[model samples]
Target: MNTDPRPSEHASPCDAAADWFVRLHSGTVSKADLRLFEQWRQADPEHDRQYRNVCRISGAAQHLSAQALRAILKQDAHPATPQQHRRLSRRAFGLGLVGACSSVLVMGVLHRQGLFDEPLETYHLQTRRGEHQELALPDGSILRANTDTLAIARLYEGRRTVELRRGEVFFSVARSTRSPFIIDAGSTEITVTGTRFNVSRTDSAVQVAVESGSVEVSGGRWWNRRTRRLAAGQAVTAYHDAAPEGIRTVDVTNIAAWQRGDIIFDDTPLALALEELNRYLPHPVHLDDTALRSHRISGIVRSGKPEAMLEMLPDFAPVSVHRQADGQIRILPR
Candidate 1:
């Protein structure tokens, strides 16, 4: 139902893939763009590989400053000799840009930096509505729990496991080949040796998004186990009674913006955004107009501040917020 330009036949694969990446992130990706991307990927194996590499680089770059990014790009563009390459590599390693440019080499660099070699500790964590918490795991990994979430970590001789009883949690796992970190979210199981990712669970569905590194998502009934390998910028959703959806590329930067105390809605359905915002608000928000539920809205609202989110609704959509006598906020057509 949407239209977009296709990559030129003569363009370099990496350049074409980069263009597609920019277009997709522009917040207006059409089905036509997706089809064109698929065609480009199918036309050459290198296209798919380059696209994945670009995604990894972009994910890693999210943590870097503008000046650091410019320095890395400059070094990459004009490394004249072997010595220059070596110098650039060292600079990259020092700036943590090595992982963005090359994952294979960054593993050794990370080892030398002692990122994954640390002592372990067991922990149990939870947070109520309007609350957020950061936790350091036994293996030096980090966990950020969102509102109304419950999680338990158990580290044993052979394995490390976390049970996400409810709500959402983001993990920055430390590499441990001897004991892979596993998260159990209802009917879904996610296994990762080292990665940054987010997991959210509801009564009907479970969702997983990989920000960096990789994870194996496996779940379903015992008789029919299904699995998917998700790379950086990829996400998967599975329902209790349905097969897991295929991997989909997403804006990893926006997936868990709540970690920054903000929630972003990019043309998201009013009903869905309201549902998410309600998780952080003590007073529930209700919709009086069923028609307004499906209306699209786009904005960034401060997390845990329902009033701020409610006040901005009219700026983007044909809706108004009214505070009821019962202390609940109701949204209706203006």
Candidate 2:
């Protein structure tokens, strides 16, 4: 009986697989190189398995933002000795580049060697309930996050993209001819060169109100994309799984009053007003009666101090506020 090991079970193919994986992502692989890679991959079963393992390991790391990868690499800045480099390389192949330490070292070395192109920096910003935050972006743009807002900004070399994960944000974009400021709010995407606008994203809808300059709003699915351009004082709403609403004129000053600790409602429904107010209070305000939802409210409500607003609500409408045992405030008909 022959006691020889099969070629597919050998370790040499795994080593070659790792080298090919690095070369493929170097951004300079030619068509002939890819063809040769395919031949090599199909030559041995072990080669394909190793390639798939490398892919699975790198998939999760790809989701990591460029900033996070850089932060990980910054933790170890000293040049690795020849022995350490070889050890790390061996560990990278053995671990399939899945471990955090091995992944960081491999990515860092690949980046320095121009084998991997770095992606854009991604930043996550959020504000708690009843809180507000202001940020100055690297591109000189200003962002004012409202209460309970969650946003992610990805600043690439050619474009600046901000995704409004939840709630509302007011953006004062700086002028940049080379890079456009884009915001992805749920289903809608608002793009502008340099404009001031407010993007509010709810559970089922997104609203974009342009305060100054112009913006292009695009929504709907990938196949049937809908787009509309809005100028100053114009607002647009896009419902989830629905078409974009017609642009309407709005009072920019009243819409943006929340930035100054005030919530202005001009013939707005009571339910909508309550929803906006609840964003700024620890305890949410709920309307007990369905009919009370249609009550039109037109006034300036103070933020952070919900007691005054609750007190004045009874005067404006025939509704009473009840403080529940659970610290929630319910509005019902008197």
Q: Give the Cα error of residue 8 in candidate 2, in Å.
A: 35
Off by over 4 Å in 1: 1-122, 219-225, 267-271, 286-297, 314-323, 329-334
Runs in model 2 lying further than 4 Å from the true structure = 1-118, 221-225, 288-295, 317-319
Deviation from native of the Cα of residue 103 in model 1, angstroms: 48
- Global lDDT of each candidate: 0.71, 0.72
Backbone clashes in candidate 2 total: 0
Tell how far residue 147 is off in model 2, in angstroms: 2.3
User: How high is the lDDT of residue 140 in model 2?
Assistant: 86
lDDT of candidate 1 over 35-83, digit per residue (tens): 8778888888988887786575443322222344333322333324555
| Distance from true location, Cα of 118 in model 2, Å | 6.7
* Candidate 1, poorest ten consecutive residues by summed lDDT: 103-112
lDDT of 2 at 213: 92
List, residue by residue over 211-320, the lDDT tens digit for candidate 2: 89999988765334578899999988787756687898899886677888887767766876787777777888888798887789888767767667788999989998
